[model samples]
Target: MERIEIENLAVQIRAARLEDAGIITRHRYPGEMGEHLAVYEDWLPTVFIGGVYLGWLAQSDGRVIGGAGLLLINWQPSRTDPHPLRGRVVNVFVEPDFRGRGVARSLMQTALAEARRLGLSTLNLGTSEQGRPLYASLGFQAAATEMWLKIKTEHGLSGDSPASNRIP
Candidate 1:
């Protein structure tokens, strides 16, 4: 593998191209390596379509070590507040070999800074059991238990789907 200088890492972080999807996806889903290539084929275009920001790739010796990204979410109004809109952090991943090396921390810090720069008042994310401690150390709290309910339709739900049915 080609050794990537830390200085080059910074430069690549700024100039990441869509063609780098393979590296990012592999880093994001390590255990499911068999599915990595396919997963990116399906999800990458949507990320671009949705305009989400994929974080920098951690490279060492020209190999991808980790990846991260943010998912923007709108907050809904609560009884106490008239406005409800917020951003969410998502898709944080670090390769096993790179764990504990501060790659994930650096990615997250960059993401949080970007979120703040975007003027988001609050950021939220759901975490796997393995990721909980890292998130907590970064000041993320478990506000509630998260659950997913999927409804399948031949043509998928229409725009008329009830607003309350979606996660906020």
Candidate 2:
């Protein structure tokens, strides 16, 4: 197979718009149920409300190749600390054809720059097995042991089923 020239691909990191919600959602979690789109659409407005930053579209001759972004995540106010400094690197995705090139690295660099610009003290992400190496090379260290427990609901859950364990 011919290689996609790294120099030919131009990544443009910009703020995500409402119209790009579908693409962003699908890119974030490929193979997810169609109904999940609603969840992202609902959150898009709020996510970008206080001006969440988003990276988008690695373009080559006007064809979009990949995208990534950093979101401004805020922890809930509590008695101990009213405000906390935290952020999340999310929606990081690259087109299959663009893999092996520097597209993802470029996107991540942009995201980190944005995080620093936003004055966030820490940034977090949950990565799949395939993504761990890439993240590790970028200086991200595995800190805590994350655990999850799922309980199946009766009547066979459908695409429209609501997620019960949502955080406030």
Candidate 3:
């Protein structure tokens, strides 16, 4: 893709179809990440057909420049949301050359709009440090209450003991 200023580029956003699975997968994993990760392409069609996963693509001159997806995940109803389903924004990526051209922002906005149309009040996403500002600008606050721990049962354990690494 040619390096073009945002104003000079005319990007079009479109709904993703099941056939775009390959395109979306490339954008989502991109390069070596796909090789190291476990990706199940077979299940992608079901997500689209089932209407549980919504995706959008950004294109310029008929070439895809970016894409994003929202997974409608089932969760136990909580006091604040009282709903069994919520939205999880995923795979927001823009080509290196297309960075800073508002492609990612456009894709996200479309996903959010779809979520709203489906009456989803709560949304979540995991982002890199670089994506923090854009998400923040879009009113995504730091979910400070959330934490993660990756367990490796096959490898047993390594590094500091879990007890020794306690927050306290």
Candidate 4:
């Protein structure tokens, strides 16, 4: 991994690999401070293995301090571009000790570069209140309408194949 100095802090930023999946998963905080929450259930390298997801890791002193992921979403063709390529930046995190030192900024820059290289027409991300300022400064606009659906295994979802008894 090549090292880059940020704000006088020597940091190494490298492409994330399959072996780093656990590191990325473990580093995720998933919510506000003191939330004690994580996205453990979805912490799999399948996406990374599938090649649609590209990620980067920021390391210092032989340990990973931060990371970011870019996921390419396949959507229906639009009018302007029959096959519009869209990328979503996710899992942007920096260790508490490494915050405010440009680690996240560097990672975000790297992700953007990769997105451009991949010919992505649009990039999107959902930011927490704390990260809003940074993202806004980087030119990410707010989405006017966003909707989500969470499938609860105990209720709408079932432990076996989403209640369909078969995996889709």
Candidate 5:
């Protein structure tokens, strides 16, 4: 069967392969610290190779135009989901030129389908305000009081911060 997005655009939303690691990484363009990428960039290929992290890629005209990643997480049990695990949709991105063309949406839909195939009862994501409406339209609600605490030794975090290396 053929996969297409946007009537005549010939976009294909397909499983990203190990060979696509570089292209996917380029699209993600991680944070300033780059620690997440540094620790897990190679691991992307490893997990995909191991069938642990399934990545979705959107391609058009022989170029990667968008992408997203899905991973199973062992989150605490919730009333809505008694299961010990949930799915995480992360690193969603689309080329600037491809915005408003449904490339990101296509990638997300693919990820959701994969999650259902994996029998995940719930899914979650962290998103910017710009992307909120699209995600909300797809049934993603903001997590309750989701918070972030980046404990870096250089950032005045207590010596007991998780990032601290020297043992007390």
Candidate 6:
């Protein structure tokens, strides 16, 4: 890990590895912050080793303070984008104590650099209200017509009601 000083804070940024899967999974779930995807524990290691996902970690004093992940998805080349690969920026998180100190910004910059190096045509991310400003400042615009649907099957989604499936 090479040390980079951000706003007077010395932080080291490094590429994430398969051994870091457990820590990365915990950061993604963060108890009470979001829904826990139990399968991620098993899936991440495969992705990490398969080269489908590349991630960066920001550490200070030998402890992880922030991180970001870039997932490459295969897509058909369109007229607008001639590249067959698209990148999704995922699981960007910064510890509360490290916020507003350029940790997230550094992590994102690293992710973007990797995307460019990989020849990805477009990079996309889902951001919360609080994270919107930071992403917007990095040249990400609001994507129109984004929507999702949850299909109920035999397994069923816990506490899910039919009304909840409708797009608002």
Q: Residue-wise lDDT of candidate 5 within 93-138, one digit each (tens)? A: 8878778977788888888888888778889876767679989999
List the global CA lDDT of all models: 0.62, 0.67, 0.78, 0.75, 0.74, 0.82
TM-score of each: 0.67, 0.74, 0.81, 0.79, 0.78, 0.88
The candidates, ranked best first by lDDT, are: 6, 3, 4, 5, 2, 1
Ranking of predictions according to TM-score = 6, 3, 4, 5, 2, 1
> Between which residue pairs do clashes occur in model 1?
2-61, 3-61, 75-84, 75-85, 75-86
> What are the per-model C-alpha RMSD values against the true structure?
7.4, 6.1, 5.8, 6.7, 6.0, 3.4
lDDT for 15 in candidate 2 is 50
Pairs with backbone N, CA or C atoms under 3 Å apart (clashes), candidate 5 = none
> Cα deviation in Å at residue 154, candidate 1?
5.3
* Model 2 quality (TM-score): 0.74
Candidate No. with top lDDT: 6
Tally clashing residue pairs in candidate 4. Answer: 0
Ten-residue stretch with the least lDDT total in model 4? 159-168
Off by over 4 Å in 6: 33-37, 155-168
How far is 21's C-alpha from truth in model 1 (Å)? 2.0
Which of 3 and 4 is the better model by lDDT?
3
For candidate 1, lDDT tens digit of each residue in 1-168?
A: 112334334312332357766666665455554443575656776765666644566566556666677766556766764446566775677777567756677777777787778766677886777778888999999776677786667844233422454442
Model 5 TM = 0.78
Which parts of model 5 are misplaced by more than 4 Å? Answer: 30-38, 76-79, 153-168
